[model samples]
Target: MTQRADVVVVGGGQSGLAAGYHLRRLGVDFVVLDAQSAPGGAWQHTWDSLRLFSPAAHSSLPGRLMPAQQGETYPDAGHVVDYLSDYEKRYELPVQHGAQAQAVRRDGGRFRVETEAGDWSARAVVSATGTWSRPFLPAVPGQDVFTGRRLHTVAYRRPADFAGQRVVVVGGGNSGAQIAADLALAGDVTVTWATQRPPRFLPDDIDGRTLFDVATARRRALDAGRSDTGGVASLGDIVAVPPVRAARDAGLLHAKPMFTRLTATGVQWADGSRSDADAIIWCTGFRPALAHLAPLGLRGPRGHIPTAGTRAVAEPRLHLLGYGDWTGPASATLIGVGRPARDAARDIAQQLSS
Candidate 1:
């Protein structure tokens, strides 16, 4: 079946919802397509203990502030999921669940979006699918032959699953630190946290909101031809959330340089020393989910779609939200997505009206 709208959003997560809210307020007709069967987007796939980097209020979409969890300052994955689900219903966004977008292409004057559920032709398209579906694992020698259990952060559910196992956790980002701490606190898993560089923990109070502000300020200064003031990245890599702080204070977390290579039953370090690990967990990051836009041929040599703000440089009718800083100052975050979404909607409205 073919459905038509003024716009079509390719995700139903926080980004997609934000785009929907703005598009609706602008009096644009749109439908959001989600691959997942339910609400919450990737939050539904997050581990049981995963917590937001900020409090609920600081991590909310536009039109509605996320309600606080009574006893927890940093809300858990379930709390985020609940908020997203509620936000969708509260705004009455037109999101079609279980509609996985397969490909998108220019169909004459309109964009045709093909999905598992059906087809949509829209005057404008919003690609809001974030990076969760495309987990990135760096290529390491001998990793292909490692006999032990190998896992990526995407599939990880809980620390209890790794209890009593000798594990090597790789990656220097927030995920690696959090997962390492979770396993250590389980009291049974033997962990060796590995990183490309020494992990730098941000101040206890420096959370997502603060980082977003600093990053934004730095970006604007640079764009205005002023000297780079500095971004949150210059301060640290890790957010030092509650669990990581507790684990660090308790001396349960320590970092080792990443292993040179993986052995059949362990990893070998640069010093030629080896640590026997029963499992290897790659807490590496993710790439932007842009496979659906492949047919558009918009991605450049750097694997990114060139954009003027959120709108594609080549295809002005397409706007990409929530990919990262390049789309907007901090468009990937729930709170930060609001401004970019509004701008994208406004631009679309103007473009269509003209």
Candidate 2:
């Protein structure tokens, strides 16, 4: 027999947890299906040195604050993982670990959530399955023939393994800058930062918290049907973290335009300049992890399912959360995801109650 709930939250990451929090408050019967064996979600898999761009107070969920760390402005990955585990226990949210949702299909007016453990029949389904599982790598000419070690940001753990090598870090995002800085600081590797366009750096005073506020203003402006006049920073711009700022002072933040193609030994620039590299790190970002939702026939171009806010446009009973800004303004961030999760929970509660 299939288990039943009024709402089934797929992916017990920050977004899923947030959704569960609001649903519990609304007295909605729900269960969170998490693929991992323990708490922390994707934070458990990130690099050892990875730190949030915002302080603990600003990077929190709906009901609780992420406890601040001593002598640390931004908490590290392990700190976040510990906090998430504690948060789940503190709230006593019903989250089933190691229950990977394989497929979600419409069953008459309800939805069937098929997982490795068992099937769950839910009145509504909220997919908070984030993008960590799906790391994207862009195709460059002769990439297949390149013999050097290549890795995506998801697989990267630390810089110790990259010592005494020529490494090319690709992409203009925060991950790219941080990784490149890591390699440069390793003291034995030659690092080259490459991007399709020059990277935009946020002012030294700007951080993720400020970026979130900027995003909120933009969102409010859009909702009010007015152009955003706030000269807020773009979230994509690189934050001047301590390590990154130090690297800049050491003259390691210089970046070159993206190469035209990959050679067997390294990369070739548009001007025919060749840089020999022992490894390449691609920080090209990710696509939404929506493969399980394929059975619903909701995926459109670019691996995105069209949505009215977080609700699926074609299937009103389904909601996609925490993938990116497309679902909600800054929905992929810890501070930004709560708004959408709360709204989604409210909608699901209303639908089930009605």
Best by TM-score: 1
Scored against the true structure, residue 231 in model 1 reaches a CA lDDT of 82
| lDDT of model 2, residue 73 | 96
Q: In candidate 2, what are the lDDT values of residues 165-264, reduced to their tens digit?
A: 8999998889999988887877888899999898888888889888887877888887789986453444446898878888888998899999999999
Looking at candidate 2, what is the lDDT of residue 284? 96
| Total residue pair clashes for candidate 1 | 0
**Any residue pairs clashing in model 1, and if so which?**
none
| Runs of candidate 2 exceeding 4 Å displacement | 228-236
For all candidates, the clash counts are 0, 0
Q: What's the lDDT of the predicted structure labeled candidate 1?
A: 0.92
Please write out the lDDT profile of model 1 over residues 1-354, one tens digit for every residue.
Answer: 799998999999999999999989999989999999999999999887899998999999988999999899999999999999998999899999999999998999999999998899999999999999999988999987789999899988887888788999998899999999998888899999999999999988899989889878987887899998768778899999998999999999999998999988899999999999999999999999999999999998657899989999999999999998889988888888999999999999999899
Which ten contiguous residues of candidate 1 have the minimum total lDDT?
A: 228-237
TM match of model 2 to true structure: 0.97
